[model samples]
Target: MTTYKAIKLIKRPEPGPVSPDIFEVTEKELPKAGSGEILIKQRQMSLDPAMFGWMSPDTESYIPPVELNTVMRSSGVGEVVESNHPDFEVGDRVMGMMGWQEYALSDGKGINKVQADVPDETVLSVFALPGLTATQGLLNVGKPKNGETLVVTGAAGSVGSIVGQIAKAEGLTVIGVVGSEEKANWIIDELGFDGAINYKTDDLRDQLTKLTPDGVDLYFENTGGPIQDLVVERMNAHGRVVVCGMIADYDKEVPSPGPSWVPVIKKRLTIQGFTMPDHFDQIPTLLQQLTPYVMSGKIKHRSHILEGLESAIEGLNMFFTGDNKGKLIVKL
Candidate 1:
């Protein structure tokens, strides 16, 4: 009762892909809820593409590296087991940097209570970081107009899937670029996307040309690779690109070049790379805009949950491998 399970980062990962040796699953003393604090017991934690950047020692990223021998940093949905804070009561479900641990203690800062009447898995998927990223980056940055062409890379992913759906809801024509034929079908057929291109196939540019005959007015760039190069080439005048992630480059020791700027200048493209931390203050506004879509099933999601904390090490690699069928989560 005095101790709880946690996954601690014993070593920083090398300049390549995620490996099992970097983390150690161990027991830690349960944290106490001090005055003006709330203690949380984690129910489910997300495995995101951004976590790949958190693991690399040499990577200078939007956030600092997870200090060695500490609990590996993560965000999760948790139940309040104890509370001394004025704002929170016992049994309240909250979300924040609960890390790869069974319990967390906070003073009601940086955490938001889940307000929707949905399952914990749904809250963790579209209501948390993934949904916010999609909503903000697409609407605030991409700014698609009705009947315009919208293209999304990593179209089968948690963020990309929602971005396409939101664009469709706004009456934009959505074309998804995915890694597999099944993923292509999932977005186009099941998700109501106008078209899809399988990036693993050699005819990427050809497919993009055919699907986007009108040219893309907005590109939601998630996986940066040849697919992105092709998408950028097909951009219309004054096209907007929302760079949310680069899962394709996460594992490479030496990162490759992105799409050239010559075309960017000719097309007058507006490209912005976004990190969720800088946009945390806007989550409330975003949730208000995004929650209804989720509630109405207009913004749908799929979760591929692994069974335990021990699976986190391998589960993280799924983001890069395209092995994950949906939003990867670790169910504790």
Candidate 2:
């Protein structure tokens, strides 16, 4: 009557490169919901590239670091199995920073109500951080304009994929940069992007020159590395760069040098870096703008969902390795 499975961060990742061995799933006694708190049985946990930063030692960031032996921090959707709060009901489903545990004890701060009938995939992809991130970073930061040439790195990912489609809807040309031919085709053919370049196999400069003949007006940067430098080089005057993520350097012990700022001055580029926590107040506006495209089937998404808490450790590696086809989530 008392125990449930949950994953905990057993140790911090080392200084140079990191591995998934830091996590361990174990049985823990369930905690009773006190007055004004609720008990939630988690259904799904969203996997993201941001975990890299979270696994490291504490730093000034949108969220706090995961202490050793604590439930690894994560966002999840769950149902209220028991409640001691006035606002929440026993059957109500909600989403929030529920971490990697099978059940969460919450006082209802960041949690939000979720429709029971809505597919978990949709909730995890478009409505969660992925979709909100794309909306906030691209619309608020990138500021896409009609007839502009838009380039997105990690274009096959949750945030980048949505950004490309949204830009297309707004009357801009969308070009995706992915790591494979299959992903390249998926973004262009399935996701309606105008063009796609395979960064791993294709000649980077050649493809950028051919595909972006007009130069990039807005760059939705997701992965940082040589690809980022190449994309920066192809940017046009007055271009905007929306810094969403940098999966390329996630595993590196020592971070590499970023793209030079000389181009920022010469091209007069606007470069902005953002994390979702700072923009939480804008979720409603983002959802209002993103809902129509999602309902109409314009904003398509994919996911590589792993089952159970055990896979949680392995599933995170997918983001860094490009092994996951789409959004990554751990289905409980």
Candidate 3:
């Protein structure tokens, strides 16, 4: 029997950096594909901020918490090594929620084939959750208009970068709020953002005033912190706020208080929070909306790759540290 390593959630994490002790790594005998199922040899796994919520004990989140003693939940790109299903064949490339393991067996419910010719990195980086989230949040939820000004927090991250680029493509003035000077430069110089605010060093209000002289028309909230209030204060009347991830407060015992609702009432702002799982059924439509931007060269992406499956354990901390340059993936 062939064996493969898998990580299981043995204990619920406390409010802080993820502790390695909560997970138990073990080796198990690999199983063959059963009737109407496919076996995948996962090549790359994505590390997302959402995993923190999934690991928590909260039962009211958009998705259920990963049950203790089960494989850690994650999405990955893989190739079918064996198939008992008619729709998938051996050697077919695919992507889906395969969890933190070397091999995955699925009944072909959510799994989708990777038909694009691009490398697996691109598939996981741009076309997977990042791009899908960007499209649904910015385009469907935000409803941006041409000549409007847009500010996206966590602007250099996987989803935020795509949101800024898509806003720019739609003729909006895009300003990004990033953590470091390097990220600010990359968003402005390379991603063609109108301007960037380094939340760490820059004066948040001063830079926001200078960059968005005409009040923000759309705000893409990715990281919740001090800057969130400043951005909300500068929004135009009837502006849209798309709340995505709140990484800054993810590990805290208590999340920071949200911005006052006075402005929200006075400005008549529209605010909505969304997760990709709710929009999974519309994936084909979202991909249809996002593919043109990629095919036409408007979308550009970078990936920070870690080696081996176990590397995923430490990679989760990088989200809080802002160390990973681009889409964080573990190459197995």
**Per-residue alpha-carbon lDDT of candidate 3 for residues 1-332, written as tens digits (9 for 90 to 100):** 89998999999999888889999998989998999999999999999999999999999999999999999999999999999999999999999999999999999877888877899999988889999999999999999999999999999999999999999999999999999999998998999999999988999999999999999999999999999999899999999999999999999999999999999999999999999999888988888999999999999999999999889998999999999999999999
* Candidate 2 off by > 4 Å: 15-20, 115-117
> In model 3, what are the clashing residue pairs, if there are any?
none
**Model 3: how large is the Cα RMSD against the reference?**
0.7
Residue 153 local lDDT, model 1: 89
Tens digits of per-residue lDDT, candidate 2, 181-204, equal 889989988999998888888888
Off by over 4 Å in 1: none
Model 3 TM-score on a 0 to 1 scale = 0.99
TM-score, model 2 to reference: 0.96
TM-score, prediction 1: 0.97
lDDT of 2: 0.87
Candidate rank order under lDDT: 3, 1, 2
Give the candidate number with the greatest lDDT. Answer: 3
Q: lDDT for each of the candidates?
A: 0.88, 0.87, 0.94
Query: Which one wins by TM-score: 1 or 2?
Result: 1
